[model samples]
Target: MDMKTTSLPLSDQLLEAIEERIVTGAYPPGTRLDEVDLAKVFEVSRTPIREALIRLETMRIIEKVPRKGWVVTPISPQSLCEMFEFISELEALCGLFAARRATPFQIQQLLSAHEACRDVDDPDAYYRANEGFHKALYAAAGNSYLLEQLTEMQRRARPYRRLQLRAPERIKASFAEHEAIVAAVLARDEGAAAERLREHVMLQGDRFNRLLQSLEGFGRAGR
Candidate 1:
């Protein structure tokens, strides 16, 4: 993808700022996002901020309050599970079709994308490279509808997915999984590629659940 930094529209900029903050945990879940404060921070009027908050609300990222402004939505374990389950199916289908229809060029692109993530250590870098790998895989599937749904699911899952790369070990494991999937796709093994992708996505959900359980335990211990 191009690295162009095109200027965002006022409302889009506001939305992006809030989304970045939330994804980075700067504004943790359940924190009330004050429209006036955000407007001042972004140096814009409340009109754009209001519009941005409405958009976020539509994404289920924020909840509109009775008297207060929008508050960050709390992601429950159940909701996380459901989201991941849906994504697993979508991505598995993508991988299946990609194996069936991927051209040599597309397979090479997927391999190159996986190679890019081989030794990435920085969390953000690893995350971006991993995302590229998935997107390439989705495109290789050659199903426009599948690609669109996968992209939407990815956007909705971004915040939680960002948390998955907190450890270098997780990043390494993810890259390894990507490599295996690429190998299967290149070999035109549709069933194997789909199985690998399903396992990979499900493993991510498992890791997230384990992290949540650990956090709950730590909270109970007042840590």
Candidate 2:
């Protein structure tokens, strides 16, 4: 909650960089992580890489595996589903409160963030924009505690969520959902906004299964 208040130390910088690669699927779940290689990649020493991995392990984003050393934590279907369920409800709450409490300027921020998500060609670009829109929504809720909790949940779900957009046409579908969410919020229709936001973010049935497979195949060949 207190993050980004100051310039990051070297270990923290490497921590975020490694976290980015893990969430972006550059270092997929189940892939073994070598501190030496990571040090080389970041042009730092093993000391910082070790510190970063220790932090990631504490967060359970990566773990020490027997015989394998450090590896990205495997995504369990149940755990992923549980996280999404919580996130969906939390986001729904954000929409509900934003509809009721957001200022005109906050609404304008939402509009701008939503527009940023428009017309993005690449999945990563769209993902970044999508993240911005969600952050704007979270802030618009006008509750500091809710913002903190939701942002933490979003952090934990980042890896799975990022990969979900890679499916063909998925980004398009997501954008359509966003439109409905924004429309409901702008109208100050709290119920509609909540429902739209919940439906947009839920991971279940076919979508859940496919993502589980992808997350498990999950790793590079032979990983």
Candidate 3:
């Protein structure tokens, strides 16, 4: 049987599952991923596996070798730092533009997104609301091209963001920051919005670095 011919959205499903595994450290940094084994384990065809791996490679989550299949990319502390610096600038700009350009309706929508996060008890739901809040802010900026670029950057940073949510305190702090940003937008305070957004993004990077260091220390102790 050609297992790849299944009616399911196998490629997408496989990609999401693998991505989750990677983010949760099931397949830690630098781990080797075996396509045939994953295919067997997932009870799917090799075709979907190949497609998923290719997508991951494009996302820089993994690297393909001529004869060695795929190798997972490590999330180094330095890389995380650099990514946060870039993200901070993007978000700060988005907030600044949003403050000046957002209509009353758009400001309301952003506020609603922040409120939604308060009712989200699960980490996944909280993350979804958190994303909605940011995307709403970007939309409020009224610059389609800039929003597109920022969205792509967020996609590339998804794994690290997911890691950051492992700490509930961090999630609460993020929501608080979102509230501050929304308040600034409502008041049309561009400087406050931009400064708060920058601090929010930079704080994530700082906390993530500390978290990574602690995880490494725990690993060493275990060894």
Candidate 4:
């Protein structure tokens, strides 16, 4: 399968644009994003704009106003921390299970996805390919219920994760982390896979610090 598609679905393209703007501080929390304005900006009709807004609403990245328009959702630091903690543990559990249960075919899929990610330089292209990598890992866990939960948690954290990848040299760092994760899983080292996956999912040191600084700036702008 061609793992990297340069184009996203129309609504998804709009969603990514708006999401990038919000996470990067171009559209701070509580700033209004009107359908008409967005439609004009994206050169699309209101239909796709509405669809994108609805998806963002589900992700809790934006909210519908009472007859006004949509606004970016404000995220409290505590809430952001809690969400990341939840995703970290959830994905770590997946990695642990995957180490024990992933079939040879699944491992190959994981490696392929990683290769796709490595071949892409555009952040958006890499972002899409990166989803394939994680999805492969999630499927390899061999637990449908767990996968469902992790998928929802991942959806909720999507915007922040995209922002995380935008940090300087973060794409390389993330790929390196994935390499460690892949090696651990290939070795059937459950403990190592779990630890590496947790570290990969959970922001720390410079990355977490940078994210906190951005959140603080967004918070101040919203206030």
Candidate that scores best on lDDT:
4
lDDT of candidate model 3 versus the reference:
0.79
Per-model C-alpha lDDT, please? 0.79, 0.85, 0.79, 0.86
RMSD of each: 4.7, 5.3, 4.9, 3.6
lDDT of 4 by residue, 1-223 (tens): 1214535678877888888778767788779998898888878899999998999998888888897678888888778888998899999999999999999999999999989988576666677889999999998999999999988888889988877776788888889999999999999999999999999998767888888886667646645
In terms of TM-score, the best-performing candidate is 4
TM per candidate:
0.77, 0.80, 0.82, 0.89
Regions more than 4 Å wrong, model 4: 1-6, 215-223
lDDT of 1 by residue, 57-138 (tens): 8778899888877898877777878898899988889989999999888888888898899889876667778899999998
Q: Give the lDDT of residue 39 in candidate 1.
A: 84
Q: Would you give me the overall lDDT of model 1? A: 0.79
Candidate 3 lDDT over residue span 1-223, tens digit each: 1236534477866876787777666677677899899999888888989999998897789888778779878877778778878888889999999999998889889878888889565565576678898989998999988898888778778666766676647788888888899888888899999999999887454586666765465445533
Worst 10 residues of 1 by lDDT: 1-10
Worst 10-residue lDDT window, candidate 4: 1-10
Cα error of candidate 1 at position 199, Å:
1.3
Please report how far candidate 4 places residue 138 from its true position, in Å.
0.4
Model 4 CA RMSD to the hidden true structure, in angstroms = 3.6
At residue 43, what lDDT does model 3 achieve? 88
Residue clash pairs of candidate 1: none
